[model samples]
Target: MVAISSPGIGSGLDINGLIGALMAAERLPLGVMNARKDELNTDLSAYGRLKGAISDFKSAMGSLGAIDKFSVNAASSSNDGVFTVGASSTAAPGSYSIDFSDNGTNQLAQAHRLTSLDFADTSSSIAATGTLRIDLGGNSFDVVIDASNDSLDGIKNAINSATDNTGVTATVITVDSGSRLLLSSDKTGAANSVTLSDVSGNVAATLGMTTVSAAQDAIFLLDGHQVTSASNTVTGAIEGVTIELNALGATGTTETLTVSRDIGAVQENVQAFVNAFNDLQGMIGYLSKGDLQGDNTLISIQSEMRNIFNTAPTGLGTSLQFLSEVGIKTTRTGELELDTSVLNEKLAEDFNGVAELFAHDDQGYAFRLEALADRQLAIDGIIDTREDGINARIDRIDAQIENFEYRLTLTEARYRAQFTALDGLLSSMQSTSNFLAQQLGSLPGSAAG
Candidate 1:
């Protein structure tokens, strides 16, 4: 008959288990909130994927929106070993006869090979002191050769480190006789010739440096007109064309250089755009059949994209007005298929017309798509608005779940307090009943009478 402090011990019932079962019922709303939050999170992730796909499509459209992309020109030389060529959009389609006299030369000055003289490695010092005057083209600068920089390698380093030494580089070349300091001009034209003279000391005569190669101009003839270039790469010879002379063409042997619109590059760009559009379409299709089934936002986006394909472009003053005209067609499965032969034929027939169809000043298909994507993906746009709505719902559900959890805690505590008191009261009643029965049994004289 010890005081039963434990709730279940006093009544011989599982009071704690009962309280747990009651609290489980109270937590039902929390489960619902969690499920709803998971659904919203899935939707948020889906929208982010959709936004990324659309942005990729927009970038692909950018290439098609520019006329220059379609106007790419390729230049080819009859003998590529002699010269390789490149052309910009401004180049006119034509042919030219190019003749080269000799390969362009760079101005070079080498120090006479010193046989007996030897110094420490590149960092060693010499006792010689002098100021070396260097001239390149018309510019002149003086390099001071002091004890700190008097060695052969030190003079090379000094020439290289001079801030005012333009168009000149110095190097030390090893030979069977000895190491020689080699100085070369960066420029190749005769006007960029280099010379060296020691004004203060015998540094120039001691180094034995003299000109090995004189700077000369590159002489060539384009369409029977004389052309002179300072460098091997010549521009402005043909408008929008840069000619890179590899090796000098044989004297009097004219090579043919041809410039034409590059239909291959145009085809590649178009194919890229088509591939990007298909990828976007496939992503939308997957979302529609999966997590976003019956979603109105996804349905609207898909409809608008399909409409763009079907609609004929406006304001183009050409026969090629639609993508279909260029052999781009939509299939039943919502993907684009390209007929390369037909597209190539169209490009060959009217390159300008093809360019206008996709990149016209106004109402071109690529331009329209670019504008649409920009608006839809901007801040506060449709995708962002949808995400905000989903987030707001999730926040509200979280608040409700927190409030229910607090209420359940208080309710469990109250139930435990009441049940404990009841167990104590039942124990007292049992004790009272036992005392009364014992008193009755003790009356032995009354029972005999």
Candidate 2:
């Protein structure tokens, strides 16, 4: 008989399959390590989500921490067609009578309409080549025209792209006569009048540049006091108020410009804060009910946040010390609800008191929340620390898994060698038993003869 080369060939037993089942049992530690790694990764992801929610809540609190939000002012013009008004926090509540002479004009310098020349094709080269000097408000710059950029469109592009153009824009327009290059100055003051001179090659004269509209000032009477500005948008005419002159009103007709506290904006900001808090609370509730259920870290964060809502703000020696006074209250489901009617009444009754309650530097609820969030989201804070611990555990588990795999590989090899040797031993015993039986049968054949 030929020597059996494959395991279990002589014994007719499934030795390799037996070894595989045994190896599977031996790799039990690997399964445990994989489960542990999965848990750590889940915890890290949960912390990441919690951190983001808290950061959003912190940003919402920032709006309430500023007194400016409560002091926002709304300005209105009686005749909006004449002008639009805007007010800032610094604007004092008042009304002004504003009258305009005309719609303020911008300083315009146009190249005289060229009737004889026809350069409608943008690629057509200009007959002139030289450096054109442009002056606006005493600021001077030069536009260089050469064969490379001598076309009408090229010249337009050159002037617009000048480094020191300083509020000058150039455009090519097609008229009944021909193509005309128009240069307009964005600066409206008389001091910013546009002037072009051809230093060489008669570039300016060939282009027929001339001042069409003279630089003028915007004249308006604010409370019967004549106020002049270089631009249509006038600032500093009144403190914290910007007057945007659109069109001239009827002669001698005065419009009322009213500035008042914007109570609606204050209410909206309060509502936004409440919404943010509720969203964060909902996220926390959801996370706690899932993979992070019974997690002490999440429980502690929830407890701290809820405690802030339950406790009255300290150091605010005012009637509006608690959030409930401002119409913000917590519900049984751990979300914030806002009562707009009550909030509006409180704001109407005592605006300053309400402002101080939320914006006080030391004792305000928003300030406290901001500080708490900043601490928890800091680099060495609770979320980061918890994440680091989870990562560390995961790394340790990875190392253990590697070691366990290596040990399992050795265990499988040893088991395979032992089983193969047993198969050989069993085959040899069977061969010996068969030979002895054959010799006994041959001796008994003499009696049969």
Top candidate when judged by TM-score against the true structure: 2
Give the worst 10-residue stretch by lDDT in candidate 2: 107-116
Provide the global lDDT of candidate 2 against the true structure. 0.81
> What is the C-alpha lDDT profile of model 1 across 377-396, one tens digit per residue?
88888788888899999899
- State each candidate's clash count: 1, 0
For each candidate in turn, the TM-score is 0.79, 0.84
lDDT of candidate model 1 versus the reference: 0.79
Q: List the residue pairs that clash in candidate 2.
A: none
CA lDDT scores, all candidates in order: 0.79, 0.81
Top-scoring candidate (lDDT): 2
Over 4 Å off, model 1: 1-23, 101-127, 133-135, 138-142, 163-167, 197-202, 395-449
